[model samples]
Target: MQHILNRMIVQSMETDRSWFEGDLMERFLRYVRVHTTSDPHSASTPSTERQFDLARMLETELRSLGSTDVTLDEQCRLIARVPATGPGDPIGFMAHVDTAPDFPGEHVNPCVHERYDGGVIELGGGFTLDPAEYPMLSRYTGETVITTDGSTLLGADDKAGIAEIMTAVAYLTAHPQIHHPEIEVIFTSDEETGRGMDGFPVEKLRSGFCFTIDGTDEGAVEAECFTAYKATVSFTGYSIHPGSARGKLANATSMAATYIAMLPRSESPEATDDRYGFYCATEVTGGISKASATIILRDFDHDIVKRRISYLEQLARTIEGSFPGGKVDVNVDRQYLNMADFLAPHPEVLDRVRKAIAATGMEPVIHRIRGGTDGARLCERGIPTPNIFTGGQNLHGRYEWIALPAMVRASKTIVNLVQLFAG
Candidate 1:
């Protein structure tokens, strides 16, 4: 079985040079055109009704590609099975269907630049992606680059992952002699809003482990992620007319501003990198009578995250004392935890991924994810899932872009992984 898998890798390498035939890029372009931005405020499974549009389309595509047991659940998660030709543990591949709510994800007009000249790309509306700012652009000097028209986010965050997974599954289906084991492909919704795996049917997947194709750069394989929590601080103040506001009136907005100002400037998203954690204020809105601020706290250390939450509660009390008549409320909710905790017992899962990545002629770049992925939640549920990149950069914004050749490499890596697992 190992010998057969080795020969298969060699053949796949030769065919991968032109395997896509433009299908990968076409699928990505088509996906970004649909508006599937998730809403954080919604309590529904998908968090957005429009996510089904893409889910249904992917279901149709999966069935047409000869997939079996395809199912689109009520949560808008699309799962399918590619039949096996050999005996091995079934492998699972996942990617999200929804875009982030940080930026506009509607009417995305993607621009494809073939044989990029390694120069500054001017994406209209006075937005230009300067290579000097993002040196990674030079790596794909003569390759095909895809970007947004500067009006909306490109949705490459996970859509690029989706396209790569689809392309890999299609390639396997076309070549019946690949000798891979049964493969499970899943497309989840509301990943951006952090509820991606809330409705996931883990028992039904039946795979020993899974990999989430949702990261940046081609060689990255994320095994560690931050423990995440969301904190909401509400301030209630007494309102009075301006003429009598001297001592009786307490402004809620002013109290909220004070709390924000008290946050450590050194412990912010812009001030940290790598494994460093930070507290980020995502939203703040208020008037004279009532105001609320939503903050996202993250750290790789579970204890540190708890300390951060405690600090927030203490700060809220201090603010309440400063304003005699004002009341401050702090609420914290756990989002997800570091996958490393769950993955530690299953080092073989990451080892296999590294070997597969190296088989594609690229060094595996193992790194810790500062932000959470669906793998974090899935791993907590005993799936031992990790993240793989999709050749995307500047995700969740208009400057987001992807390299077609890099994406091809990612797809090739996926194919190699399947063969390795099956062997």
Candidate 2:
């Protein structure tokens, strides 16, 4: 069944991509033009109304492809299903629609270098993507590279994922005899703000196992991710007149800064690599009377994670002990755990994925992710999912790019995975 489906997929791919005459760069440029940057400050489901623009567009595209049961949730998560040819568990391909909030996602004009000749690819005067600075540029010497216009982010961090998934689905739908299983497609909102799945109905997702096509590089595959937790520290202090407040008043801002300074300088995302754990302080804001700080804790090992949490608890206690009557409130919440705990038991999933990659004649580089993903939460929700690359590089930045051939190969790999599961 696998061999037969592969032949069919190859044949389907061979057909001139005339239908997909829609250029990915064109779609990506249009998507980036829309202001869909998620707002961590907003309380709304999507966290921003602009994200709906992309959500609605995807809904229409899916419906146009004759996909059945296409709909968008209140939170703006676009869900659709392409019925299975016969019988098999549904597999979902998920990607977020929102761009990162760290950078501007507005007025993005994507530029394409047709047949990149290597060397310095200038974004503008002075600012350029130099091969020497980013050695990765040397690899795409002969490929068409898409980048931003030096102002706003190219939004390829995810818009690339959306386009690939859409193109693959469009291909699958157009070729009915490809012999594939049911494909579940989900376009999530607010992923940039860590709330894409906040309102997602996991039970209604309709897929036993899913894969987030959100990885970097063409052949990269990930089955493990970080166990993430968020820690918050609040400091309350007595405020008095500045001149006479030296000993009588405690400055909350100073207290918060002190706590942040106490964090281990050698143990952070920038300082740590591989499987080593680290604590990252993301936000700190406060005034004289009240202050708050947010920190993220991550590790691959559950035992090590627990120990880190205990350390954080002790750190908070020690800070509270120093303030005498000052109030120190500490809150630690578990965000997501590593999916490896679940994927480990099901070696067949990895076996099938390995075979799929091998079938594509590409070397699969299996590595543990340094960050968290929707797959980690889904694993906790009883669905063992993994991460697959979309051939994108330098994600979440203005210098982001994706190779055309890599995108084509990834789509073929997706087709192969479906065929393998169909068998």
Candidate achieving the largest lDDT: 1
Q: Please provide TM-scores, in order, for all candidate models, with all chains considered together.
A: 0.85, 0.89
Model 2, 1-423: lDDT tens digits are 454345555655656344443445556556667778899999889899999999999899899888889989889988899888756778898888998988888888788887899878888636688789878778888877877777778787788778878887877777777677799998899888888776478878888788888888767889989998898988897788899876577788877888888888888889999989898899999998999999999999989878877887777677767765567787989899999999988887877777777666578888799888877788898889898887777777777766666666666677778876785
Query: What lDDT does candidate 1 reach at residue 43?
Result: 96
lDDT by residue (109-200, candidate 1, tens digit) is 99999999999999999999999999999999998999999999999988999999999999889877777889999999998887788857
Which pairs of residues collide in model 2? none
Candidate models: Cα lDDT each = 0.89, 0.80
Error of 1 at 198 (Å): 3.1
Q: How many residue pairs clash in each candidate?
A: 0, 0
TM-score of 1: 0.85
